[model samples]
Target: MNIDVGILANARNECRKLLTEQVGVLGVVISSVDGFDVASAVTRDLEPAKIAAMASSIAAIGIVVSQEASLGASKSITVNTEDGFVYITNIELAGQLCALNVIANSSAILAQIIYHSGEIKRRLEVS
Candidate 1:
C-alpha cells in the first residue's frame, strides 16, 4: 500500500480516458477524499480543482448522512436530471479515498466507467 503521486496521477489519467472514451462522458474528475482535484477533463472555464474540493465535501456529507441512516457502505451514488446524469464513485487506494465524477446520459454507462476505474485503481494500488 505504498501509494505514490505517480500512481495517483496514472489513476486519474485512466479515469479521464474511461469517461471520455468508454462512457461518453462530457467531463470527468478525480479528487482527493478531502476535496482536492487530482486530475480532470473539463472545460477551461471550469475550475476542476474547485469542483473536486466541492465534490469531496459533498461526499463527506453524503457519507455522514448515509451512516446516520444506516445505509451501510457506499459503493457509488448517482444523481439524475433532465439535462444529464452525474455519477460519483469513491476510489479507495491504500488508505486514501478519491472521488470519481462522471457526467453522462445513462446510468449503465456510468456504472461501467466506475467499474473499470475501480479495476484500474486496484491495479495501481497493488503494483
Candidate 2:
C-alpha cells in the first residue's frame, strides 16, 4: 500500500495518543499490509521495523489458519509471553489495508488493549 501523508500523520498521532493513555503499552506501530512501517510510537528501545514485518507475516498466517478451519476471517492475533503481550490487528486506511501492532508490558490488561485498539481501528478507518 502506498502511504498517504495525511493518513500517516493521523496514524502517528493515534499511536502517540494510545501510548500516552495506556500505562503498560510499550509501543504502537502502523504498517502496510506488505510489511512496511508507516508510523510508530515507542517508549522503549523496540524495533518497529521488525515488528511491522512480523505482524504482516503473522496476520497472513492467521488468515490462512482461520480459513482452513472454516472459522471465518481472523480478527486479530495476540501473543502472550512472560514479560509482555503483542497484539496484532488490522485497519483499513484510505482504501488500503494496514496492520496495527501494539506491544505492552505484562501489566497491561487484555481487555483494555482490545478495547483501545478497536477504537484506534475505527478512527483510522474514518480518518
Candidate 3:
C-alpha cells in the first residue's frame, strides 16, 4: 500500500498530458487495482477517490466476465451516458497493476480516444 511518490507523480504527469491534449476529456484518474487513488489529473468538479473506486469496480467486473466467457484479458471498458463517456483501461506500470479511467464529454471521438489510450499504455509500460 505504500505507493512511491515518484511513480504517482509520473502517473499524474501522463494523465495531465492526455487531458490537455484531448479537448473532450473531462478528467483522468489513475488508481491501484485495490481502488486506491495513485494519481489523478482532473477537473475541479471531480472527486478522484470516488472515481477511482468506481472505475476499479467496473474494471474488475470486466475482467471477471472476460474470464467466465473464455475471452482474453479485458483491455478496456467504455460506458456511454447521456452527457458523456467513461473509459476504463487496465494497465501495468513499473510492474505494478493499475487502472486508467478517463471521462470525456459527448463530443469526444471514440476512435481518437482508443488510439491515444493504446499509446498511453505503451508509454506507461516502458516508463
Candidate 4:
C-alpha cells in the first residue's frame, strides 16, 4: 500500500489531467507532507518544487490550527484570494499522508476536484 515514486509519478499525471479537464484549473500539484513535489502541472512561469514546499508549509499550519482548535481531523483546507484560490487536502494512502493542491477561481469546482482527488487517493491506497 505504500506509494512509490512510480505511482506518485502516475498520480501526478492524473492530477494534471483532472485539474485541466474537470476543474478548469491552471496549476495543480501533488506534494509530499514534507514539501516535495510528487507531481505537478504548472505554467512555465511557476516553480513546481517551490510551490510544493510552500504548500506543505501552509498545510502544516492548517493541521496545527485544526489540532489546536479541537476541530478534529481536517480532510481538506482552502484559502481564497483576489486572484484565485488554493486548496490543500490530505491524501491518505495506505496510512501514509500526502498532500494535494489545486489552484483555481471557482470554489465549487475546486471542492469537487478535491473530493475527486480524495477518491483517487483511496483507490490508490486500497488497490
Candidate 5:
C-alpha cells in the first residue's frame, strides 16, 4: 500500500511537536518496519537514517522476544544508557506497521516520555 505524502508530513509535524513539548528530548523519528525513514525531527549531530535503521532492528527484536515468551505483541522497547534514553515503539494502525523512535537526555522523565510517546504513536497511526 502507498503512504500518503500529506499524512507523512503531518506525522512529521507531530514528531516535531513531541520534541518541542517534551523535556530533554534530543530527537524523534518515524520509521517503517523495514528500516525506511518516514519522517524525522533531529538535531544536527544526529543522523536520521542511521537512527531509523537501528530503531527498526530494535523494534524487530522486541517483537521476536515477545513472541518467544508468549507475551503477545510488543508495544514498546526502551534502552536507557548512562547519558541518554532510546525509546522505540511499534505504530500499529489498521495493521500498517511502523516504528516511532525517540532520543532523550538522561534527565528526561521516563514515565512522561513514554506516555506522550504513546500518544504520538497513536496520532501517527491515523495517518
Candidate 6:
C-alpha cells in the first residue's frame, strides 16, 4: 500500500478513538495487505507488528476460502477464542487496500463490536 501521511494520520487518530472511546477494544491495527503495520493502537503489551502480519495472512486465507466456497469476495474474517475475539476486515485508505484488525475483550458485546468495526472502517476510509 502506498500509504500517504494524511491517510496514516487519519488511521492513527481512529485507532486512538478505538482505544479511548470504545470499551472492550483491546487493540486496533491497520496494516498493509503485504503485512506492514501502517497504524495501530494497542494495550496490555500487545504486539502490533506480529498481529499485523497474522492479519494479512488471515485475510488472505479468508479470500481463498470465500472463493472456494463461491461466497463471492470476502470482506472480513472474525475469530472468537475462549478468552477474546478478533475481527479482521479490509479497508481502503486512499485507494490502497489494508486490513483493519480489532481485538475485543471477552466481556465485550459481540454485536457492539461488529457495529463499531464498521464505523472504524467508514472513518478510516479516504476519498
Task: Estimate the TM-score for candidate 3.
Answer: 0.92
Error of 3 at 116 (Å): 1.4
Q: Among all windows of ten consecutive residues in candidate 5, which has the lowest summed lDDT?
A: 89-98
Which ranking of candidates, highest lDDT first?
Answer: 2, 6, 3, 5, 4, 1
Model 1 Cα lDDT, one tens digit per residue, 1-127: 2457787677767766765576456667877887777767864456777778778777887888899999997767777777667777787665677888766665346557667767766775675
Give the higher-lDDT candidate: 3 or 5: 3
Q: Report each candidate's C-alpha RMSD, comma-separated, in the order given.
A: 3.0, 1.1, 1.3, 2.7, 1.7, 1.3
Cα error, candidate 2, residue 95 (Å): 1.2
Task: Please rank every candidate by TM-score, starting with the best.
Answer: 2, 6, 3, 5, 4, 1
Question: In model 5, what lDDT does residue 63 have?
Answer: 89
Full-model lDDT for every candidate:
0.71, 0.90, 0.86, 0.75, 0.84, 0.87
Model 3 clash number: 0
Estimate the TM-score of every prediction. 0.77, 0.95, 0.92, 0.81, 0.91, 0.93
Q: In model 5, what lDDT does residue 47 have? A: 87
Q: Candidate 3 lDDT, tens digit per residue, 16-51? A: 998999978989888889898887889889999999
Backbone atom clashes (below 3 Å) for every candidate:
1, 0, 0, 0, 0, 0
Lowest-scoring 10 consecutive residues by lDDT in candidate 2?
1-10
* Most accurate candidate by TM-score: 2
lDDT-wise, the better of 1 and 5 is 5
Residue-level lDDT of model 5, residues 1-127, one tens digit each, is 3677778788789889988888889899988888888889987788889998899899988889999999998988989999989988887534578888999998788889889988877666765
lDDT of 4 at 17: 73
C-alpha RMSD of candidate 6: 1.3
Better of 3 and 5 by TM-score: 3
Compute the lDDT of residue 63 as modeled in candidate 3. 95
